[model samples]
Target: MIGKQLKPNFIFEASWEVCNKVGGIYTVLSSRAQTLLKEYGNKLIFLGPDVWQGKNNPDFIEDKKLLKNWREAAAKEGVNVRIGRWQVEGKPIAVLVDFQPFFEQRNSIYRTVWQNFGVQSDKAYGDYDEASMFSYAAARFVEIIYLSLIHKNKKVVYQAHEWMAGLGMLHLCKAAPSIATIFTTHATSIGRSITSNNKQLYKYFHGYNGDQMAEELHMDAKHSVEKQSAHFADCFTTVSTFTDKECAQLLEKSADVILPNGFDNAIVPKGSAFTAKRKAARKNLLRVASALLSEELFDSTMIVSTSGRNDFRCKGFDVFLQAMANLNSELQRQSTENCKTSVLALIEVPCWMKEPRKDLQQRLAEKEIPNTALPNPYLTHELYNEGEDAILNTMRSLSLMNDRNNPVKVILLPCYLDGEDGIINKPYYEVLLANDLCIYPSYYEPWGYTPLEACAFKIPCITTDLSGFGQWVDATLKHRGMIENGVEVLHRNDDNYFDVAQNICNTTIKVLNANKTIRNKMRKNAAALADKAQWNNFIKYYYQAYNFALSKKLK
Candidate 1:
């Protein structure tokens, strides 16, 4: 039986993205980490894969003094763990586990899991084996920590993010019963698979059976692990109401807690500092564009960007490119000076790339940019899969070749912007701060952090109703969101490709044509919206979830 609300004395969170910076989950955990540290202090422990086993990971600094006894104990059991502090806004204790040795024993582990929790991984492919092995090792690490250090009576909780970490929670269910478990599926594998495969998710959501869909889509292993984890975990949570529904239908389980993603304002620039950064960012962006495109650009040039995972249809890269094409065509036909003020749309999505463009790097290094445009002037980097890339292919189809006369010049910055990419040499956030407008027209987003981040930086954004953030904005405004102030939540469904493209074109033009005074107000309004979504305001939900899990006293 559950008692009154109780706080967990200790928490161990496992995610594939602990020291890894692969996807949005990294953003989710990293941004909230500081606030979480404030709440739990050193009692919080984050476990991640030891992907950087040999080389140094700048994000993690191992402290031999910290958790010395536990490391020794774990090592004795063939578990190699490096206890360190993650270098982010909040320096929380992290353990990077080396699961390489455990790979040999995966078959036995999977067999036992199949017998106990019905987790089937026979057909698992690609990263599934690696992730399962990592999770299994993470769970083993937690078990060691609990047995060797943690008290029997102390309230404890273990939270796993995504299906990649599901095996760990399931492992803990059998190995460590005293510790409460929480499994969070950011997006159900089957649901995302369905969307990416061009099947209508919303229209036929109710009729689809998750298990049937899993087998049909060949996502049985992922769906199986995730589904079992939901049933096995003591408490289940999701990042948004949108995903909560997806979990309900696609995974056959709804979240016990809806912990919406939030931002930490501590990382964001403030007041006059913000102004200086924004101006500097804009200047740097325009300067780079001028060097690459060989075009004279003014301060009036609006820098717009769209960034996320390079899931072509899922992230709406196709629609965004098509919209840019449409907008370019419209602006070319117009005579006004405002139309002549070029819109520089940057595609910040990362992909399989060789390196920074050698010619672009040379141009950037010069004291003065050459008057002539470089070959493939639209690309910030050369790609290994130049002919096979979806975004580049779509751009070719739409003829967004960044011609000098085009009013909208599109540049694809196809590498991760971590300030050391040889060109641009600025982090995504730094480059983002300079944007006059941000467009994240996602077709399938659980909780859109990009738009929220854009708003937090006082940049106006255009999102769609399908995104959880966009839905929240619409609800906050008491109607469908519009560009009159900060966000514009355009209505998007599976069938309206060109219609959505035209709408994006229209909304972006409105922002480009806006005067300085109107634009400033828009920026303020965007930040005001962001203010309501800080971790300080949203962290309560996480605490509540912890308390609920603690009260259960799963032991």
Candidate 2:
């Protein structure tokens, strides 16, 4: 019952994260670039905001010769751009547009958008103005490229990501009706606002009105544009079935397709290389931990970690800390029987850090594991506002101090792991390889990438059913729980905070007590699950999305 596949002759993709390494969308675009390049080659043009103008952008390489004709034409139309190749796999063509000039016309542009698509921008704030200008400029760039370079007989598709690029999609719909448009919302704005504001999204999901919620949340501008784009785009899509349902309820538009995020497995090391890197990672992680805690951690010590943006409650940092406390209590009770199970749990989430702890730096420099603890042994970096910090307050409340004799020692690394974050001095993936287990217990994760990345590295992870990835894993593994199947999909709901914490504690204990054969099987199963989620397998949904958009254009 498969239908004929329709492909665009030329494709133009615009996103705020195109050349910028900001969050999960960058992974989606960068990881999948090679596959698109193999199929479309130079005809697939990526339009991004020129946020790194005049700077040495490591992710971008400007080549004046690549699109000279288009550059000249665009200049004549007042569209300043830098044509180059993105420094990812496949080195696809990119156009970083200077969106600053369009800000002068922001009011008129907003008026036009409202007139055409009913996107209310009057109450817009924060990044609304900046994102809208970039979107308008991107749309203008697409229009110029289509008219000057692309022939009239050819079919073209413009795909925009998130509300940040929704304005551009709306623009193309009005200016270039012949060109098909696809808008993908990774997470709905209202949904995120609802969750972040400590409101009950799932319990009141049906009763809440999108417009009223947006107005109440002061998210009218972003939500309006996102909803309008979904209604107007030739095809609307989202990253997961969870978000698909969110769109249906919040945006009042069903997604034309579900475009799940996929990772590039080629980035992962294989065979002995993987073994070597993992060993190195473990050594480095333990070395840092030992330096900070003043204790030498050996091969028997279990290294567990959870990392993401500092959405303490939403990313389940609260549950993670609670689980750690519970685990510590369990370990303490077991220690009475002379049973030693050392666990080094790391919280690698980024926060507003003033700098690395000077005492920890001095300890690392001495290259000697001290017998005594440093000040605030739980934190690697000093926070800007320690008194108001949620994680610190929670740790204190739970009495989960990073005691030297405590079997479960927690370390807070509140900085990005870019190989220069003083303490770790290693990149994220490099350090990730060292972990025995990773956990991302998200309360509102649309498409969880951390778990996917962990699985790709052959690391077993725990994620809740509230996440899109967790739901997918549940379906894939037929509801076989964690440790045994690599990914443990715990059933989480709004009211089960303590219950979820207990489950996480129990699961961690189970993994820690697992035999070598069982752990190896779990790792193997995790890797197998990750292989199924590679770009090669998941890119078909995108192809379906493109075909849907093209069919709409033809219609």
Candidate 3:
């Protein structure tokens, strides 16, 4: 059984995404900050790589005065650091390390690790060195802080996120034995690599050997580090059982505890405020799409979206576009279209953004939006790789342009929606409320934060069984994929691509066609699911992990 609360603690959580708005891990750490801070208060701290160097990172609020003594000591010991608070809700203390200087001694550092742990670095490539150096540097700083300052009576726990921070986790395990270390592999490196390489991961999952697959896929260096760290850390944890199984099979270690990622609804507006922001968000959505397409969208239209990183096959962007294309055809064949237009699909995945179209900008600024479609009317921002962008290519192949006669219109807002992205100048969650439906048919996902976040925002979301969130919905909520129930968790496996697409197409058709009464019920159901997924409900699992780590250290 998972254990209990770790009171009076000195906790240090490390992640490559601590203050960096990269992916799901950032959401995991940032959303959990407030709860952790409430328990540990000023004793809670986070260590992240200083990837931005001296440049301003909007997510970070630096204060040289925050830890002056520690900063001076770090400087004296050759550990370059910047002490600050993460710019999220709790404003929890964060320390960003500049690991750039460690390149000079990389060979020595690598040699030391190879000697201490059997992490072979001979075949390392790409971001291997960079991630290793960053984690290694974080480990050194953690060791210094623990050995030199922290009292023996102080209960200390250090948690490292993903394979990128695995080296740091292992380092602390070896260097500071008293400091309980936890390693969380959000997704196994080999598993993701196998899925991405188009291998039938689930079909032959049991038949495969992790080491053999790693050698075949050229993921030896990363897999070695991740595997070792998982074994060495006092408490090895994963976000969900889906990945827990993956670790056991691929990394050869079962997680001691499953710390599922949770959401914090503090940023979500209540009652009257929610109604107002949602109205504003809808207005923004319609205006942006209408202005870009130069055609007015009726208020009765439904806005559909799929978002997250631009990993085409892995994130299932290919399937989404194909499904939307099928949706356009299906809606066109309908006896009579009830809604103003069938669907307004937004591909909010960030990629190769050059700038927002000046013509589109001028149109939005005008008293009335221009009636003529701008050049490349389907795209919100100009892309540097327009000729080769996967989304654009897929859309063109499926003939999904925002043609004036098409019932379903598609637009690609391929830029980060951080309020300053020339079009739709609003943060992601602020605009997320406008969506009538959200879909994430991930081919390779560990926890699937997008679908969870979508459900939390009261939007009916359709996800696949392969995603961790999707599995949780099936087991917890009884796999009820009815429109009246809000979420549709489709059965997706390595072999069922077309089936998943057809399901998404049918699901959207049914959900978007529902009447007002049914839609409200769906919203209510989605919100209920979100309530169950809040950090308050999920934070106990983390304490359980910490408690286990502390117990392991005692052993």
Which of candidates 2 and 3 reaches a greater lDDT?
Answer: 2
Worst 10 residues of 2 by lDDT: 332-341
Which lDDT value does model 3 have at 312?
90
Candidate 1 local lDDT, 67-93, one digit each (tens): 999898889888999999999987999
**lDDT by residue (tens digit), candidate 2, 1-555:** 125788889989999989887788988898999988888999999999999977888889999999899998888999999999998888899999999998888989999999999999999989999999999998998899788888998989999999999998899898989999999999999999999999988888899888999999999999999999999999999999999999999999999999999988888998999999899989888887787777778978999999987888779999999999999998888786643438999999888899988988888888567798777778888899888888888989988777755888888888988888888898898999998999888999999999999999999999988888999998887875576788998888889988888888899898999899999999999999999899999988988998999989776
Give the TM-scores of the predictions, in the order they appear.
0.97, 0.97, 0.97
| Better model by lDDT: candidate 1 vs candidate 2 | 2
Off by over 4 Å in 3: 1-8, 335-340
Weakest ten-residue segment in model 3 by summed lDDT:
1-10
Q: How accurate is candidate 1 locally (lDDT)?
A: 0.88
lDDT of 3 by residue, 376-396 (tens): 878998889999998999999
**Root-mean-square deviation (CA) per prediction:** 1.9, 1.6, 1.8
RMSD of candidate 3 to true structure, Å: 1.8
Q: Predictions ranked by lDDT, top down?
A: 2, 1, 3
